[model samples]
Target chain A: MTRRIRVLIAKVGMDGHDRGAKVIARALRDAGMEVIYSGLFQSPESTARMAVQEDVDLVGVSILSGAHMTLLPPIRQELDRLGGGEILLVAGGTIPPDDAAALKAQGVAEVFTPGHSLEAIVRWIEAQVAAARGQAAW
Target chain B: MQPDREPRPGTAAARPADPGAEVEAARRAYEEALARYREALAQSPEREGLFTTLSGLPVEPLYTPSQPDPDYLAKLGFPGEYPFTRGIHATMYRGRLWTIRQFAGFGTASETNARFKYLLEQGQTGLSVAFDMPTLLGYDSDHPRSLGEVGREGVAIDSLEDMETLFEGIPLDQVSTSMTINGPAAILWAMYLVTAEKQGVSLARLRGTIQNDILKEYMAQKEWIFPPEPSVKLVVDTIEFGSQHVPQWNPISISGYHIREAGSTAVQELAFTLANGFHYVEACLQRGLAIDQFAPRLSFFFNSHLDFFEEIAKFRAARRIWARAMRERYGAQDPRSWRLRFHTQTAGCSLTAQQPEVNLIRTAYQALAAVLGGTQSLHTNALDEVYCLPTEHAATLAVRTQQVLAYEIGVVNSADPLGGSYLVEALTDQLEAEAEKYFRQIEALGGVIAGIESGFFQKEIAEAAYRYQREVEAGRRIVVGVNAFRQEEDRPPEIFRIRPEVEADQIARLRRLRARRDQGAVTGALAQLRQAARGGANLMPYLMEAARCYATVGEIADTLREVYGEYQERAVI
Candidate 1:
């Protein structure tokens, strides 16, 4: 019996457009993953804590209020502080290319924009989880 | 001539003696033609198995009289008549062009004031204020939650002092203003009224619109502070108060613009917006206010998206549906109450950051659709809006885009120019039916508030958004710059950037105001506000008093928050 991948999707800060986050969560669930969705207006602290408690394999944050620069770092830091550093962090929304690169440099594994596909996101998450499991075995 | 015996005008001179025989021959010919088409399709099949509009409405290859043809007079009356499908006014743009109201706000109050004056000088007909996230969420600039966000997206109005500065030197009576704020809309509106009073403009003389529609906040924008029940009650209070005192002011603009911006399809935007409007009407009726007295002041805001025909159909359907519901369902007597006046904004969601200049063309077409659909006002999204707040040059270009359409283009000479088109009429009927289906489903869930509590609206919108994204990803739908017609080397446009000092200055000003104001009067007014909130009394007058005493937005919102606890939204997924 193999383990099912667990993912946590969250919306950080005052950005209330959660259509992307919700859609991603549903697609992950349909792909046979266990998904926990943190509803709108969640703080970084709460999101990080929720990820640790849920013991998810990945944490996805969506921000469209142009607060990605101010909001993403705190979530990354909280995840590290809570000992969930291994949980792959992915960000997506109306993020500029420059800021996406900066966010990636600051420990975000991936940054998806408006036209990014759900299938691509699911594939990336699966590959990362499998690679992590292989490393643990080694 | 006898009707049955006279030959049809366009029929052949020599034809079959029997009508049935002629029909049989025509059917045979059509079958042969369909077989030939199939053979052709086998060599080059259609692009996709099915075709649909932006709202996911299935499209047929062709439409004819046999397909869902509605009665002309009943479904679409003349302009300014009942069930105003053509338009609300007899002379829509011919009499006077739609108001060119560009929504502009950024940085501190003084900075935003400069932008407002600049826009007005450039021929912007009216003012539309976009408050910062802090103000939208009912927080003061000095609050911990407001750090780094104080004047980022829009103007920061923490207190009446800031509001006063925001409108300084602009006479309130001369220009109408539309504020885009919810959650703490009553508080901000009070500040505006107070500012106008200080400007020596009587409440009766001031004309503007306050986007106090709280239902859409919970449904889409998600800036809700209080729970649904109390939040709706607050909106009703403003409507009742404005109807009695400020007759010229629109207390609420039932907004579908944000709903569409949140990735809902056109039909969802229409159904959800109209459902919310009906809910407001019902709530006001329960409050014992006459329908006609307050209904005339209600307005709507919609998004004109990339799908030209679909967007036009949505607007026409919206007017007809609202007019019918106002008269038949709610029994409104006044013609003004039956009119569904609305402002249209080109879809911000449709703008792409890549090849940002292409967005100019997108906006011009969307604005054309709005004009053709007979909008009362319009705001074209700036080309660089997808990147950041628009630069001064970009915003000016956005206004010029509207000017070209209003003056250079010949579209303004006619009202509802697309009304008689076969496709437009069919789509209008189709959208009206789809909206009616949603209205039934919402009614089944008890009402809009109950449906929201059950997470119905969120789930539907999410599903639609996901489907659209999947289509774009799979190359089923082509977005010019992003998925198709890719460009290799490009130079990113210079976008506007809000200065960091704007937040600091705003905070310092708020702190100073807190120190120097009559603290005793502030305390007294706040206590009264709290009392009014806790009781069954209308809280608008108390809010006005608090504003007069210079109570900060956060203070008044927090006072009400104490009475009605903050809302916590459940995850729909």
Candidate 2:
């Protein structure tokens, strides 16, 4: 039997622009993955709790209001506190390259920008899930 | 190319007196031209396999008289006439140029106030306010949910004090203001009304528009607070109140700007926007208000995208369809109810961060299209908008782009300058037909609210957006600086950055206001608002009392939420 990779997507804080997040959710579904979408205006604590409840293999956060610098750290801390640190975390939306690099260093698995292809995102997620399974076996 | 030859015996021209023969002769000539085009195509092929507009509508190589052979009087009526396909006004820009209103607001209210004054000094005719994420989502500056987002995307207004400061010196009766707010539109509008009262301006003397359209929030912008039923009730309440009290104000501006920004096609923007408008009309009718009483003040806002002809055609069709629907379907008698006045903003999604300066040229062309399409007002986006809020210089340049179009470009000299072109006429009809099909589908789904609940709107917008992204990635469509004409540069354009201190200052001010204001009065007013909401009474009067008491936005919104409950969108995609 094959295992289906489940992922959770959410928009945190007050950013209302969700077109990018919706597109990513649809693309992930089309790629034959199980996806759960947490609708808009979620707090970081609620988002982490939902991710843990869903027991997903990956978590994706989309922020476009330039609040990533102040919003992501608390979300990352909450995820760690909830013992979901192993759940691969990704971020996307109008993030500058400098901020992208900073977020990656602060425990984000990857960061996607405006024009990044969906195939690239799918490939990255698949690779991360496979690597996590191998580590679990070891 | 070939010269005209002598008519054959069977050709229509052979019998000049017969009109049917002449039609047959024209058809024969068209077929011969097609054959010649195919032969030439075999030798030197066209650049692309299928040519299409940005919205993916197919276009023919050439349009002729036979295509879209519409009667000029019926289809393309004179300006200011019924079925206003040409324009809503006869003189258009010649009588008075479109108002140059720029959308500007950021950082603290004081800072935003300074920016507004600067724009007015720069010859901007009107003001359009952009509220921050917290304010739009109904959060006070000091709320925990608003921690890092205070005054980031736009100005933060927590109480009537902030609203007063935001428009301290500006005369509410003279300068018309347009606020780009939803979700908490009623609360903020109450603040504006109280501020005007403090200035001794009568409600009947005020002139402005509040972007109180909530259906689009559920459809595209995703800034909704309460569920559809209550949110829509609140919008209708404002419309009802404005009609009786503030005659010069537009209570709701049915907006398609965010729909196109969310990546819907030109036809979808037109269809969805008009659908929302019709839904609003039905809601008002259900309230027992006569259609003509409130319909005249109902306005629209649309996105002028990069597709030149498609955008113009969308506008023309929108006016015609709206006029006819108001007259025939709604039984409206007043000519003012038939007129569809709108404001146009250049598409923000089309602006590119790469080669930022090129966006200026793009905006200029879009402004020209809007003028030709006969928009009542216009806001041209700055070059650096895709990165952050526009800088002072960029906002000025955006305003100048409109000035150049109105004065120097000569496009304003004639109304509906492209009214007679066969291609433009065909595209207009094609868009109207496509929109009718969507309207039918929406009707079958039990109207716009049900369509939203069923995820129909979300699915359509998502599919359209994804398809556009795929096209850009596959090199099928070229977005000059993004996909094609790539250039390597060391540094990007200098973008406007909000200081971290802005949030701290705003939060502190909110806390101080809470400490100093009459807390008992605020609580009482909010309780009254809650009681009003619990019943079927209109909540505007109660909200006005709360705003006058200096109640925070969060307090008012929370009071309503207690009764109506907050909305949690079902995952659509």
lDDT of 1 by residue, B1-573 (tens): 112222322233334778787666545544553454345334432332224444667544322223222244456655666678888866556556789999999999999999999999999999999999999999998887787678888999999999999999999999999999989999999999999989999999989899999999888889989999999899999999999999999999999998887789999999999999999999999999999999999999999999999999999999989998999789999989999999999999898867888999999999999998989999999998877888999999999999998776466655587887879988898888889899999999999998898889987888887788778878999999888997863675786788878888999999999999999999999999999888969998999999999999999999999999999887787
Output the lDDT of residue A17, model 2: 86
**Runs off by more than 4 Å, candidate 2:** A1-5, A127-138, B1-70
The number of clashing residue pairs in model 1 is 0
Give the per-residue lDDT digits (tens) of candidate 2, residues B232-325.
9999999999999999999999999999988899999999999999999999999999999999999999999999999999999999899989
lDDT for residue A6 in candidate 1, whole number 0-100: 92
TM-score of chain B of each: 0.88, 0.88
lDDT of each: 0.86, 0.86
Q: What pairs collide in candidate 2?
A: none
> Candidate 1, B547: how far from true, in Å?
0.8
DockQ of each two-chain model: 0.51, 0.62
How high is each candidate's TM-score?
Answer: 0.88, 0.88
